[model samples]
Target: MSTGLGRGAGRRFGSGWISGVLAVTCGALGYGGVLCLLFPSWLTTPSARALYPLELVRFLIYVMLVLGFGLGALSVVLRRRKVLGFTGIALATAGTLLGGSSAEIGTLGGTTAVGLDWFLLNLFILALLFVPLERVIPRLPEQAIFRPGWTTDLMHFAMSHLLVQVTVVLTMLPAGVLFRWATQPWLQDAVAAQPLALQFLEIVLVADFTQYWVHRAFHRVPWLWRLHAIHHSSETMDWLAGSRLHLLDIVVTRGLSFVPLYVLGFAPPAVYAYLVFVSFLAVFIHANVRFDLGPLDWLLATPRFHHWHHAANPVDKNFAVHLPWIDRLFGTAYLPAGRWPEVYGISGSPVPQGYWRQLAWPFLR
Candidate 1:
């Protein structure tokens, strides 16, 4: 009887492993194929004279990212121990691909060199920042962490920033036309007279404020919470977990977050700088790294603070993104002295496991 029970357990484990591997394989292939079909231009290498011609390299890098994510997901599904290692490898490969000369995409001067430098710098910075934390965080319980799939969460995060950047650039076209068609010379002159730094600050502040409100709204509205919950549902809190937001949520929140910055006349350079800085902070705040900022916690957000937001109990606090001041001012701040929630994620609801289902669930419901 004991032998039979052992055999039954072994068969169940084997079956689970097989199912996970198949899911990862199918997800990667399906995602890659769909991306290739939908954005054929993204796969094309531009002419030699093109300022940013890194299209082909970018495509290949994305492929590697997909594969790496697949491997990471597979590791989780199989209950293997190399999930972070595989994810790191994938991130490194993506960095290398973006660092190559062929991955340039914009009219920025010295496109190839600039792209290479930015890619390498960002890769190094993110790796240095998160790799250590990945090492430190305890392995999450199986039920709490989402099993890895196609790394769609990362893709979602990337696409949100990328689309926002692209849209900001496109807005300049209309700004130029308005400049050309303006009936009020004083208005144009007023904008021109504004100091570069002040103008930049105005843009960033506007964007930040907009994002804070949008985030708050997501929590306040039940329908939207369905989409947003996917982000909060991750039982395991880590760098990658920050990328788990649904695409619809990304579009709405990011679009609202960016429009104010664009309309306020924020220079592209300033916007880029702010984004890089905030991106770094976002990763740090969501990371499993242990650090205490003491009084500074009241001023800025951190992992410990944000983790509380992800807690299952008393789900009405910690909605501000970068600044806790907003939460405090609005009476949503719930941090108590020397106390932290013991567990994170939604208490009840049948959440989907894979990226595709999560993406489609909002629409289906």
Candidate 2:
């Protein structure tokens, strides 16, 4: 890979842009095809059910097929990067042909549901939103769109998104099994009876407090630190970098965090709302967009607050992911007034570069 550009200097457009477009196109097609063939039951995502009808999604797939072929043809005719363009077209065609035939639509009752469609949709929407935001109000103005480790981070993002079903299952397993023993219908009923606004607040408090301690443990414990360090190894902080997490980290943090929420028994609607809100905040806090939250920074975690957590100069502080007050309360918080870290990433990170390698890294060394 080429050396990453400093602030404001963009990557080489021809190689970077073509490769990226080809990668995303091929990745979507490949994932879509697999879901269609082996896991048709998992195709319908929660976001898809809530947002659009199945027919609309089908129409969009058809449109994508045409666009992919058109782009491939144009690239081949122009004799510019024909290989990538052709590969993208081929994948797109195959995926469309394989997955286009849908017998039924809407949300289906099942034990598993992958967020493939949701992932792609989010990829598009977030790219549209954050790409511009980063470019205009970039925290690191010189950072290129296609940074050195972008592909690795993209793989992490794709895997996490694609394996949403598995993740959900693994995360809920603790809650499911443990809550079975502590089942209290009356407690759940009482909790659900509360106002939606109040329920949301309670859910946030329960989840964040549990996560804060779990996150701290992942840092202080040497064994767990091996896994958590993958998240801190990214040299550049962006919306996508947030997805570079080890599977162990995800399963442990999310699974343990779910315990309190389940035991407390918040309503499904409020729980969903809190999930949506935190999801947005997770990406937002990692985003490259520069903003001054001022007083809000102390109350809530923002990009600036979270960025400091990833800074090489002080890698041990800012363990809180949601509420800054949690960090402040525990005395792990470290934020300077009107300043950003001059550097990011851990010093001499042992975490490997690729997704597969990082997955096995914790077990090895």
Candidate 3:
């Protein structure tokens, strides 16, 4: 209810900034939802399509559109930047005009597609979860959601999500061929005989062990570092920063990480559980929230622990993704009690400015 002006470069927070942001987010997602309905094969993800109920999705889209328009109106009345509200309002209105949730389905099938649905779904979920978390328990209170290079990070996020199909294929192809002979039926049964919980733990250990070396290789190998540097290039560490990884980096690391799991014949369910856990863990370590885990910080990697790895000069401290023990064993662990990095990113800032530029940067050099 406070309509007071905000400080720090005259940015207005109380005067409808929150409403405008929410409106734009909801409006954009709602518009995308309509497009998915109209072209499910080309725009929607198979995982979401198979799992989500159509009626429920339509209802959600309808709700988002209504809220986007209504909140945009409210933001327009209370904010100086009418563009924010108008943009939100326009998106919602356009979705509605294009038939919104009632958009007719095309005859085209799912023979070919990208992950637009995945991007929208993930963006909504990640933002919904992390935005409030950072605001409430922030490592840097002064840090704004839309910080410098945020747009670049966001573009990276969108591109990665949209290419989920490609990444998945590339990751699994070599893995399947290399590990097929080793996926013996008896071995699979023996591995699967273990309790699901135990299997998941093994998956975590295997994944972390494999990723440790792969991650280290990225830093040590100059050519690989060129690609991996795009991830380190993010000057500001946040949840989105983790999503700034180069596509080749994602594919190669993931491909090798899967090698151990696939060769060992872990149950698919356990593998899935580890995948979900790693997804969250990756984002959590890069987040703007810091936790004092006491001695437990040595047992697992935390934001403070990982942030030091992103420090300006020596950006090769922590190498383990989950277990910091790997780093300690390898002599790369660096953690000063109750301290975070004062600065992040590379010293000379060799990485380019834009997403497209950075995509080609590693190759150019």
TM-score of each: 0.60, 0.83, 0.94
Global local distance difference test of model 3: 0.87
How much does each candidate deviate from the true structure in C-alpha RMSD?
A: 9.3, 4.4, 2.6
Candidate 2 or 3, higher lDDT?
3
Tens-digit per-residue lDDT, 285-332, candidate 2: 898978887878888888999999899998788877788888889999
As a TM-score, model 3 comes out at 0.94
Cα lDDT tens digits for candidate 1, 77-174 = 54443434344344434444443223334332321211222222243356555765555653332222233432655555544433443433454444
Error of 2 at 131 (Å): 2.7
Order the candidates by TM-score, highest first: 3, 2, 1
Give the runs in model 1 whose Cα sits over 4 Å from its true position: 1-125, 134-201
Measured by C-alpha RMSD in angstroms, how accurate is candidate 3?
2.6
Give candidate 2 misplaced runs (Cα > 4 Å).
Answer: 1-39, 42-52, 73-79, 95-115, 179-183
Candidate 3's residue-wise lDDT over 213-236, tens digit each? 999999999999999999998899
Candidate 1: count the clashes.
4
**How high is the lDDT of residue 203 in model 3?**
89
